[model samples]
Target: MVLSDLGRRINAAVSDLSRAPNLDEKAFDSMIKEICAALLSADVNVKLVGNLRKSIREQVKFKDLPPNTNNNTKRRLIQQAVFDHLTHLVDPHAEPYKPKKGKSNVIMFVGLQGAGKTTTCTKLARYYQTRGFKACLVCADTFRAGAYDQLKQNATKAKIPYYGSLTETDPAVVAAAGVARFRKEKFEIIIVDTSGRHQQEADLFAEMVQVQTAIKPDQTIMVLDGTIGQAVESQSTAFKQTADFGAIIITKTDGGAAGGGAISAVAATHTPIIFLGTGEHMMDLERFEPKAFISRLLGYGDMSGLIDHIQSITRDSAAMKETQKHLAEGIFTLRDMKEQITNIMKMGPLSKVAGMIPGLGGMMGGMSDADGTEKLKRMIYIYDSMTAKELESDGKILVEQPTRMTRIAHGSGTSVREVEELLTQHKVMAGIAKNMGQNKQNMQRAQKMMQGPNSKQQAAAMQKRLQSMGGAGRGMPGMGGDLSQMMQMMGQGGGGMPNMAQMQQMMSQMGGGGLGGLGNMFGGGGGGGRGRGR
Candidate 1:
């Protein structure tokens, strides 16, 4: 079973138990049985699955629950147990070494051949570089022909500085030379890519040791292929004994059916998984957080991950600042919407971003990245075709002047209906902005309360509010109702911004109409006229 299939099976089991008319111990056991079966099919270790099953049974204690307990309370306990146990299955409880800003941090990569160590080196370098670190890569894989060239190519494409020597035959010598040169130049993060073997060969271990000795690296990471499944446990254990790597990065997770097995196997050895290479793109590396990973796997979404991605890609552009100012003032213009759409494009694949939203991921259904991108392009085109005055307005002017809509549609090569759809989407977001603006005083008070002596109480109250709003199956199809509720919550000083549930609902609305209107315009079927551009 693939990761998505495994998640679906497990989620279905839980949902089935939640909806069971009896909600008895028998139903709980049945759910556990189904989850274990799903995990086993995904190549997770039998011993690990058994332990999980036992842990869940112990945690829930369904038989001991008070007879007076409501079904909702029982469901929450069971769900929490499954979530916590799954998180524990992947968490090593060991913190990986973090590089200091001013100091040189040498990170060495080691793994079996074809585990994607070379490409991952560039991805890691780019990750640190984007975070204000002067990061570089050094190729020390003398065993593999063209290893240096591959690293050179990847580095060049990512625009990261790299060091490699075709003339050097000694891996350790090349590694030491690269580290010395970068350290002298004050590079903050120096990542060394080492050679891998077909198996855990003696020669490979010896070479890894030599490179480790030469660089005295602050951290050594073992890159594992997620497709290898249960075999990763033995492979990782052998490498741990020989190379003593401090962290692990599982690559090829995006398509691996045994990704769950790989993660659980690595965790069994007590090494932290620093990242998961989700795709071939340099930007596909995801920071590993156990809770977030399991949440996303179970289709619960990862709000923190979404926030981090937003923060990572968000720039201090004048346009963005102006939009933020407008949002604060309860004003959202077409220009503001354009800036946001552009940012969404930068956030990465629509599928990935949609997955981060609690309910929107599944709602995306069959929309491909190409389709989503094309739709967004059309929206941008519509904006571009507009006059400067129209762009700056709150979309009311275009609504009042129906001819302006027809003109924009013709100029952008889209139908007038698409233009109207864009305006409708703008209206939704504008209403959100207006509500936010009206609750500016409440937001200020809430911020002050968070900083005050009773901050903990205020924070708890706010969390309670979010939890109440985040009930399962609450938003989807009828996003406007949810958006209104979210705005009302904000107005009541429940943390001025939308919570994860609200954001999911808002995204659903956007996906359904604003961002999602592509289906209608392109004849995929949402009841809007087809575009001329099509």
Candidate 2:
């Protein structure tokens, strides 16, 4: 039921379109109404959505769509229109990290309290450190007693030099000193961590200007809580107007609402979201991609850093052994299935993962991505609800007995058909699990083929074929599951499939430990915490 809001909207739109006789002006109008209603209800920017609806209406009215366009074609057109509109709202890529014609590249962090600005500063330092930059930290947040100590601790752990003064006087002085020291140390990147403050505070805004003047940072990033919704627009606007914010990093996305509002807020501001803070862990940071982001919002998985996660977490021997077991015995139990799902969920979302595959996203384009994500969540929930007996039995009793199915549906607040669909999906996945060893081998073979003497010829042929086939006709088997696994691999390294399992375990523990307050903190209880800087 996590996707209840988006799901209901998609169903309504599909239903309305299904009833239409053809893709005409009248049908397009009705579709627009459904889309507008859905997007507005989901807290999308009202004016932006309205303008998008207007554009779609005019396009359908004036442009000559293919004759004999059916509901399916219209649905696809609507999707394209929405995608194009949303893409325009996202920030253009900023210049990569390169030293300006100066001593060192200085980056400043600013945001509201508890927005994770301090943590993000450290992460950025580490990110640059990994990229061979000699990064230094500047703790300008003298307001909080432990703020200096905490940042210094992280700096020590990262083996980076840091500068902070104990005085609670002007922050600009401390920042100036930090930059001077970093310059003396011959550091390549100097990151300053400022005290968190609301943009509405005139005093804080004034203090930010002094700090900006003192450090003359190459990039000033506004770090907002991803849980904050459409209000991000105001936050971005305030900071950009005050200090010329170069980018935005939305933190705490791993736990919260869909983070859709944050995405829209960034789009509205035309500021690129540079990074997403997925968890409290230092390594849980990632660069942003608009398409992958949209796909995740629509319930897809991302695979960009999946291979890296796998490399970090899983030993080759372990994967090879599991692969061998699956191929030789061809029996996949609930445990194996759970492992697979957990691994994929870590990469981010199911759809994102599939989209990473060269030819998969286009083929699965019209599939209700939001609905699919919800379905994946439901499947995970059902697994969570199951007793050990039920899981080991391969869901036999649940499938055979209607009474049990009804009980499960009631317990899960899902329809029996939904439960049935989960079972069917499980069966298909179980088969794929058994065949994965072979598929991975084949993929490796293909990779090797591309490196061989006929590489250019084969590449040319493949490109021509893909060009002729277009995006939709390509069939990418098991790509959906591949996507899910990839995300898991990214979150934690060594590919031991800990991403979803760990999250589920953490959730279960949190749920049981009477930390009910945490759920409310995520804005899922009463839904009152709907916007940022409120």
> What lDDT score belongs to each candidate, Candidate 1 first?
0.78, 0.61
In the order shown, the candidates' Cα RMSDs to the true structure are 5.5, 12.6
Query: Residue 170 lDDT in model 1?
Result: 92
Model 2 lDDT tens row, 176-212:
9989888887888899999888777898889989999
Question: What TM-score quantifies how close candidate 1 is to the native fold?
Answer: 0.86
Off by over 4 Å in 2: 1-30, 70-72, 92-103, 130-133, 153-161, 258-264, 305-458, 461-534
What C-alpha root-mean-square deviation, in Å, does candidate 1 show against the real structure?
A: 5.5
| lDDT tens per residue, model 1, 56-112 | 889988668887999888887888789889888888889999999999999999998
